[model samples]
Target: MTTRINAVPRAVPAEEVEVPFADCYITTAAQHAALRVLRSGWLTTGREVAAFEAEFAGYVGAGHAVAVSSCTQGIELALRSFGLPRGSLVLTSTMTFCGAVQAIVHAGLQPVLVDVDAGTGMPTPATVRDAVRAYGPPAAMTVVHWAGDLADVPALAEAAGLTLDQIVVDAAHALGTSAGTTPIGSQCAATCFSFYATKNLPLGEGGMVTTNDPERSRWLHQARLHGMTADAWRRYLPGGSWRYDVAEAGLKANMTDLQAAMGRAQLTHLPAWQHRRAQIAARYDTLLAAQPGIALPHRPALGTGTHAWHLYPVRLAPGIDRDEVIAELAQRRVGTSVHFIPVHQLTYFARIASVPPAGMAGADTLFGQLLSLPIHPRLTDGQIDAVCAALADATHRQFTRKGAS
Candidate 1:
């Protein structure tokens, strides 16, 4: 008679150390394309760049897409394309990256900051109108897609009573995002996208400027390469003219062929990657909602568009210090981060709004409560479970019985 074998019970392996957030989804296709770019002798501003630009332009539903060095540069170029007068009033949300502020300043425009919605972290259309009215006629309004959530850009543009020339979108966080039926890049005069390593669709460090105006598009193409009338390759190529003209002092901000190769590969897989992002976001919503003090982000009821889900920032209970919460979470080996510290809260914005820390209630309050958990696509089910459990423990640790630590 054969003895039946019994399986021995084993430890659950300590949940595999939970998970780390923000894994870049580079595929085999990307690797192959990168290798191909290396093999191809002509690397800088080659056919790869054109192919990637065209593909991206089509994807974003824009007439032109100018690949640049970084999103910040794209924003600057967008502003500069208008050829705005120095000190022209420009309005943007106060709750934004420092790059937006710098873009305005660098373009020789005066930034007139406006407050964002307390809950949504977006500038309301009314606020845009009011800011423009108060600050005098704005040369342009740069609406950021905060947290990969598209602001009410079309409505804000409409309220300004200005042409599309007056609308530029700092869509650094909005690659595969859309506002209503139109994609994020299609709604404004110029739309800038970042491919920073941490960004949703990363290309190490690169950016794109999509626009409808042919003149603006041409200017951007030239501007990214020392304002040269022709590309360097064209100038140096066999049977090419030695002479060229530099009309303006343009910034050196061109995307290399290698970066374009990576971008092209990323773009091919962006749809699928974004699909996983949405799935992860939904999972966060379901699991995190059970925590009593956590507040979730709200999508517009009327908008029929895809949220890129680049960030999954949840607001913690008021009165609970966010730093303490983060520290406790870190002690539990949970990876967490904050979206931003508002622009006005920085020392530089003191001149624009001398609002005290307490008075800048909207931003200060939000900063103290927001926490971004691990929501990357690489997360496994068990890891996700562990993170949720860790969060619960942290929350309970912070808010339990008489608010004892």
Candidate 2:
């Protein structure tokens, strides 16, 4: 008798799942913290914000953490703190949310878009060198940790022939990420994190900047407000004088006490939440491993660091219409999203930089193939299986249609 083997059956959903591309995980403790802040009668930046800053600083192992209104503001403030000359060129990845480039432009600096590695959708040291060769040396560089995967900042700086102080990190997706015994926030000159609703540590809306430089930390605090010598909490509280003076022009980017309270509560649950995220990612990997025309997200090398798994993005093989697949998943009640369109492809940046479509081949190719799947603490195992089943069915149908045509 001939030996026989059968492929394992893929799990199908018992019923349709209304999976969303992103969802905020809110706990009862977070709700209580928000209520406590509301009952305290102080809503703006105050004691809660201070405590949150300290707690976050300790969590990330940074010497100082400054709470801000958003990650964009944090990036702008960090860049401004460097005091780079007006119209200075800043190097940044094109495969990002565009906020970093926007921050650079808002800070009176020019942005030089660097292409990313196609495999990882993140800029490598080689790409950094290419950008430098094409656009000349930059006054500063902002490295984005795409999809919670940490980039070797030290190596990138070395490739660009710049110092650590000249490097800033846009770690919006990497709050819990680490690099072989070293956390992300403490490595660069300034590392900025987001607490946007869809982020790993959701606070609805908030951001933080971590730095070891005391002077820069102090400057960020003053600059987040009105560049005043003293904030309202300092001057209006008990034994606080009404005396203050303007130091410099600053933007109002302070995080409110309400957001800080929720952040503090959410921070406590981050480790567990991160664990769930990993579990979801692993499930996705196992379910999609045998599916043709689908490539799972790239993972960093073992012992390199831990991934935060903020977004479970996968790439579709060429000749498949990504939009059609997205529509099919939507019809099946499985929501999906594209991570980003290359910033260099945006009209404004394209006009300013005058880069052709073929200039950044890596980012361009990745953009066409990328699709973000649902990955959060709130997702159930069944929902993950449903997502994979829907995706496999959608791609198989596309392949069938192509062959028929």
Candidate 3:
């Protein structure tokens, strides 16, 4: 028998518990690391950044890692490293952060927005194949590890008949996620991770690109800092040369020592943080199991992989106004968010798109009902219960309203 939290509707009280949709977890070690960087004379990309790259590479089992200012820059640099022709189509999911699509565009590549699996909100092998059939074969693809769930890149590539080198992964939410025994960063040509404030590894602003190809890694290292052969750290440091060559035009996207120091410190606490996130997700599963008019997050089968639990999104039943439910939850002092509003539906992308998107029904359907609840290391058991209770009451009100209408 499964345990369930009772969902009884009640009037809103003056002191309802407050639950934020997301929060950053910063350890004391991270704070100390930041202070140490401040005290050091060298603040730009230097020893700290190098150490963070090596540690991150080792953690993800990647051959090489290059630190960047943001995941968006990492993806752009990764795509540019491919040297694909201008206007080359890069297949990517519509249900992702705009940064992924923006990266492709910044690389001078056209983004072919592919539909995702309605159930998982991730593009599967079949979806990739469908996109290929509709848009012709793309030069490459950017696979997003949605909501901390790792997509099967090898299988998707094999099904689409593309080489591993043709795949770039947006692992913004999947720092600790793995597919079977393989970690996320090691599966593709280049995998990018975000250390954004609200991410699993909160470093305010930092990203890393992991690749097994040495040549690509070397290219990214230069590409991140204006294509210079050497950076200021090398030029101004002792026994350093000011003479350098600009091999190619690149963006200013290097990660600073301060961010890297914090990243290194936060990496140490990732395991414990991930464990707590899992526990919160399990507690949500138990509490919300019996609630009506809502669907829980999809859990991958046992042994397939581990989720990072960055976001816990539930889908509301059909005909319930998702916005109204969100408002209701806010009234009850519970915060929530929608994962995304399909990229194709965005005003800018839609107006710029040359052709209409095909096979977007899945993405369209999923976007309407998606609602992300609070799920982070800081969430306590009582908070989880409060979130559930608020959600239950809010949805019940929506259902009742719909029935009456």
Residues 207-292, candidate 3: write the lDDT tens digits: 99999999999999999999999999989988999999998889999999999998998898888788888988998999998999
Q: Tell me which of candidates 1 and 3 scores higher on lDDT.
A: 3
lDDT of each: 0.78, 0.88, 0.86
Alpha-carbon error at 116 in model 2, in Å? 0.8
Q: Rank the candidates by TM-score, best first.
A: 2, 3, 1
RMSD of 3: 4.4
Where is the poorest 10-residue window by lDDT in model 3?
1-10
Which candidate leads the pack in lDDT?
2
User: Model 1 residue 253 lDDT?
Assistant: 91
In candidate 1, which residue ranges exceed 4 Å CA deviation? 1-16, 352-359, 401-405
Can you rank all candidates by lDDT, best first?
2, 3, 1
Please provide, for model 1 over 86-122, each residue's C-alpha lDDT reduced to its tens digit, 9 standing for 90 to 100: 8887777778888778888888888877667778788
lDDT of each residue in 149-267, candidate 2, tens digit only: 87888888887888999998999999878998777898888999999999999988889999999999999999999788799999889999999888877889999999999898889
Q: In angstroms, give how far residue 168 of model 3 lies from its true place.
A: 0.3
What TM-score does model 1 achieve against the real structure? 0.91
C-alpha TM-score for every candidate: 0.91, 0.95, 0.94
The per-candidate count of clashes, in order, stands at: 0, 0, 0
- Give the runs in model 3 whose Cα sits over 4 Å from its true position: 1-15, 354-357
